[model samples]
Target: MTYPVDLIIVGGGPAGIEAALAASHKGFRFILVEAGEIGASIRRWGHVRMFSPWEHNTSPLGRKTLAVHGHPVPDLAAVPTGAEYLEHYLHPIAQSPELAPSIRTGTRVIAVGRAGIGKSDLIGDPRRADHPFQVTLARAGSSDPVSVVEAPILIDASGVYDQPSPFTEVAVAQECEASVDHYIPDVASQRGRYAGKHTVIVGGGFSAATALRDLLPIAAEVAGTRISWILRNADRKPLTAVRDDVLPERARLVEEINRIATSADVPGLTILRGTRIRSLVQLPIEGGSTDGSGFELSLAGDHAGTLTADHVLALTGYRPDTALLAECQVHLCYASDGLMKLSAALLGAMGDDSAADCMAVPAAGIETLRSPEPNLFVIGNKSYGRFSHYLLRSGIEQVETVFDALPAPVRTAK
Candidate 1:
């Protein structure tokens, strides 16, 4: 099934929604695809609220939607809870006439090949099975033949949080001791791919904290599987403080882990605090170095001394999934922070309008969002990777830019 819309949006998060509205006002037809339910993070992390408020989430177009519908404006600076952001804000914005019809939820996009049809002026990597521009979706109701959406304009609003590969993969190889392997093995095999293993996790951010809080119980239930919580910092602790924002959910997570930690009784469940991983040592054997099929790690400590383990879980952090960009052949200027900057500098580059700051990426690595191909552009969190507030502001910048690119309808003198 091939349906060509004016534009095809690959993500339905804050960027996707806002971009749709901007496209609509510009009078270009578009379709939006979301792999999970809309606002996946908000739904998955429903227990917590956003650090920024509702006003920040609302777009110029979004604000107009509220006004036309007779809805009162929300506090601009109030960061909404995850649930509130979804129910009150995201849902509302997505339902605007600007969206809805073209929004295909539960549609997960696999690959975005470089477009040949429109011959995009934007600069970036070339897509694999090139087309004018195509978006392939994995959805239940999709016809037997499957659906292939072709658009002149494609926006890669897909964010990074979704691609949590595996803590093991993210681990710095040198940090592993002679016997250590994998930073977090469980996340690598769990569910989609990373699951069912003695996974080690190390990080001080919200992602690490959430994974630990939720995955402990599941690990305990399984007979031999285990979880080793290790962190490198002053004093033995759970890396960062359990986020107080999630209050009840955070407490529940801690409570469940406590019970499991006490009952698992298996010495296998160890929490190495105040120590850092030294390196991963592969024991040499006739076939290959085999300490454990999936276990091995050596660690060093500031005051706690050094140790060894089967696998290490280093939730140090994540950069954007820039690997996918390689496939698309997108030209990326590396930011000190790893965010990709667009190529074309904005028409209105800067001003006191605060929002205009995102107009052009002033960062070193980030130059412009221009893809290697013409007419191809990226949006959402990806657009604001390093320089600007990676939140929603950069998304707005993308929305307006793409909308402006499309040909506008000429006025008729009555």
Candidate 2:
């Protein structure tokens, strides 16, 4: 099946929802394709709370959209968990009558390219600009055909949650796969699985800190349980205590993690800094049997030692999934931070500690959002690529900029 539309928006998360709303307001018809439920990525990290409060997280436009549906405004200062952000704001905006019809959940976009032209032909084809985009879609789980949609514009808002950066890019022993948890589970609910187990948590970001802090209490309660925290940066310090932060919860979390790291007095907790995993080998379980039961890691760097664990939680980071956009021949930075044109801006912003925050990096404007492929742009977290600074507020601002910069609509003859 094929449907012609004015714009095709990929992803159904916060950015995609904002794009759909912007398109609707601009009088352009669009369809949003999502591989899973709306806010699926956030749902994965629902147990984690956001550092920014509701006011900073939501946009004026989103509020208006929700208001149209008779939804009441939430407390501006309340910082919501991932679940609350989805339920109280995003879900309602997505379900609003104006945006609901355009949303297609559980539909994954397989590929995107120019209609009637291949990637090789896009360079010299004079008709390429006039040609519509061919977007291939398939059912979430099934291989069966769903439909091919054609549109003049394509917005790639797909974020990075689907792609997890491996602990080591090198090939892993097949046996090590079974002991890893890519996504953090609700530790409280899954305490039994972790009780009395030796676990290693990798990475040094907020996620890593959260995992360590959450596990501290469990370690105290469960006998024989041990925790290993590994970080690549030897110079990295504990989370800063943000006493005057607008969001007190985030401030509290930061202080808690800071205390744990600075004191180094937590029982059953060990910190390994400036370490890298050289190799992972399965450990023998019991009498004459190796069923990939446990594992040991050969390490390098400052620690320069091996560690054994019953379970490994790698909270490293994520990167954008650009496989779907390959067919469209969109230009991405060699560093994979964002569009090639954005290198200077992103780099410049990074040099300034305060500006490193994606929200602090001034709105790149809709012009900055464009890729080599005309009318195709990437927004939201996906736009940041490997850069971890992107904020929800920045994504919302990008949506407004895109709408503001949209060209005037063409009228059809009667």
Candidate 3:
């Protein structure tokens, strides 16, 4: 049976763009759909520098494609901020003549399923591969008048950055929900909001560290600028400093953030270890009220009490948006929400002390990229799901593996 397209690639990030490149090289009929402009998510956090340098972040296929189009490559050894990555690599690849016409920006994938079948229709049935995938698409942020496209295969590279985990395991208060900032804020650009104000930052990942790092200078320069860091771990050391780390930037970050937590030297800075925010509410700022314009947070765990802050930064990590593939037969890990097999492989890698360095984790085998739903694969950070250890390099490798496993296109577009 002839399908309208050989594959449907969801997302326009690095992984998605790589998949599109691979498909183009293989002469497959494909379309890459993105909810926003290509690299929209990266553009959102464009200010933050990535730990991995350009050499490790880009794929060989992407590099070749760009070189063929006469695009100048970036210095492979230099660490680039998110903006640099987008400006030098992702944007050029997406705009390359090879991929430009095949991409559809401002389009969001609503759902995916096997054509003419429900989620339960095929159970471990090899014949399931015979049916093309039915993909529902709508304009981003709209639900009216959806359109359907069919493909023999589907690749979901939609990442997790947009779905940030809540500050607390439990449901957050309405006030907290309305007030907190989930993404890393550009402290340099938003100095007016943070200067001389008490800001509370939560989470223990690189994002949290990045926020603290950016805010420390602000705290030192602005009098009355109070900053409180909340960590659920009693260890106080929120970041792990990989011994003799290869990435100099990552090593420096771990050392600096850990030093702040351990020494408590920065004035107006407070680190509350083993503490959790039980509830948060915005305090009314009335004229003459010295209580300040901010939030009152009830705490629990090691530091159980109440704290006040003028701004709250919920730097908690993100989880994959799994709802888009609700109709597909995909098994996700109970813990990471990643593909079951890949999650298990990653979890197994964690047992080794070397795995402490994300670069040390073994590349997941191609089989782990497979799902019960044939011809459907989730690649990139989305494949890692809630797992925080994903590197751009891993996503690049995933694209290679998925394409390697696919058979040659039944018919190439003329």
Candidate 4:
């Protein structure tokens, strides 16, 4: 007899954990498989602080569940760093008695599909609905499969942190692999490397702003320090809007960046707006020193000029890793944010379809989260696909909406 579980959650982040908690409360058997510890992705940016206060970050279900278990909730008004959010809230919820048994950390989900059915199976096939999902999972350290899980419902809350957007605007033949740095490195620790170097920071997102902030102190201390800020938009600075803002931290973030840019005391700062990196050519250093050469970037568009820098910080943002979903055969909107119907609703609900703008769209309930693959659902940042703006609260709300739509006596034994 196969092990039976009502739902199989493919992640253990805020969305996955919250979904697991809701499933338990609804009296359903579920299992949550995570490739790492709870809040694994959040831990990557432990140095960064979140915009939302504790209240907004914590879901009603998560907070209530934690509170009932004697977990001390942080002040609702307090904004937490990614580390604190993981350590204080996410960890507690994952370790809770209700969820701990169901969550399997250090396990990677390789593929997901319905048992005895291929992606080409016709919708008219009644067996598709009744068929249990076959989820293949592997141990983190090895490629070999440990076990296969069968469940009627599958909630894919896996996030999108691994795939950072490419640096070039168009395809280039140059081999400049060593010239790229996608993530924000702890500049303080490696101050010596960036001290006297000419660094070119790319992208117009919050990550680029944070990278700039990280390098400012180094610039002040080190002599001959030069930095170039490049972006596609020339009209406006990188900012989270202040007007009609629900989160003060977000507004403050924009304010901080603006203040840094305008400050007269901050020298060696150059802003190159409306620029596109057409190609990148690595220039070898005349004298081989510890500093590893530099990159010469070809530019185009409004700001057309070549720039050379010792380091290229490409904070172009991230995209969802939908490679695992290809086998499931779900229809994704190539132009919009989500699956066909979902993409339409998201675009329609929000007048503008920008990733950040779509975050403001009200939740369309659980029905919208479902995919064409019957019981399979996609939530969290992965659901947003190429879109950038995804909030912890929004994902938590999605979990609630999903559980709320659950049918009674859930999955029948096949």
Per TM-score, the best of the predicted structures is 3
TM-scores for all candidates: the values are 0.60, 0.91, 0.95, 0.89
**Displacement of the residue 96 alpha carbon in candidate 1, Å:** 3.0
Candidate 2 has its poorest 10 consecutive residues by lDDT at 351-360
The predictions' CA RMSDs to the true structure, in order, are 9.7, 2.8, 2.5, 3.2
List the candidate 4 regions with Cα displacement exceeding 4 Å. 1-3, 124-126, 141-143, 171-179, 240-242, 259-265, 281-293, 353-360, 410-414
Model 4 score (lDDT): 0.79
How far residue 55's Cα lies from its native spot in candidate 1, in Å, is 2.1
What tens-digit string does per-residue lDDT give for candidate 3 at 1-414? 887789999999989998999999988989999999999899989999999999999988888977988988888999999999998899999999889999999999988888788888878676788988888899988975379999889999999988887787568666557678888899999999999899999998889999999998989999999989999988867787776689999889888998888884888899999999888877876663434357889999988989988889998889998898888889999888999999989878775463277788778888899989888899999999998889899998898888888888875477
Q: How accurate is candidate 1 locally (lDDT)?
A: 0.57
lDDT of 1 by residue, 37-111 (tens): 788745755655444556556787788787787666677766666777777777877876657888988777766
Candidate 3 lDDT at 409 equals 81
Candidate ordering by lDDT (highest first): 3, 2, 4, 1
Candidate 2, residues 227-258, lDDT tens digits: the string is: 99887877446454433455567667777886
Off by over 4 Å in 2: 1-3, 124-127, 173-175, 236-251, 282-293, 352-356, 411-414
Q: What is the lDDT of residue 15 in candidate 2?
A: 93
Candidate that scores best on lDDT: 3
Please write out the lDDT profile of model 4 over residues 1-414, one tens digit for every residue.
Answer: 234788899988888888888888888888999998888888878878888899888987788877898988899999998889998899988898999999899999988878787888866354576778898999987778889999888889888876776778666443565447888777867888798999999887778888898898777778888899887877455554544667776767778888876665577788777788887777765564323468889889877878888999888877767777777757677863456666666767764523344446798776577776777889888887766667787888788887777784444565
Q: Predictions ranked by TM-score, top down?
A: 3, 2, 4, 1
Better of 1 and 2 by TM-score: 2
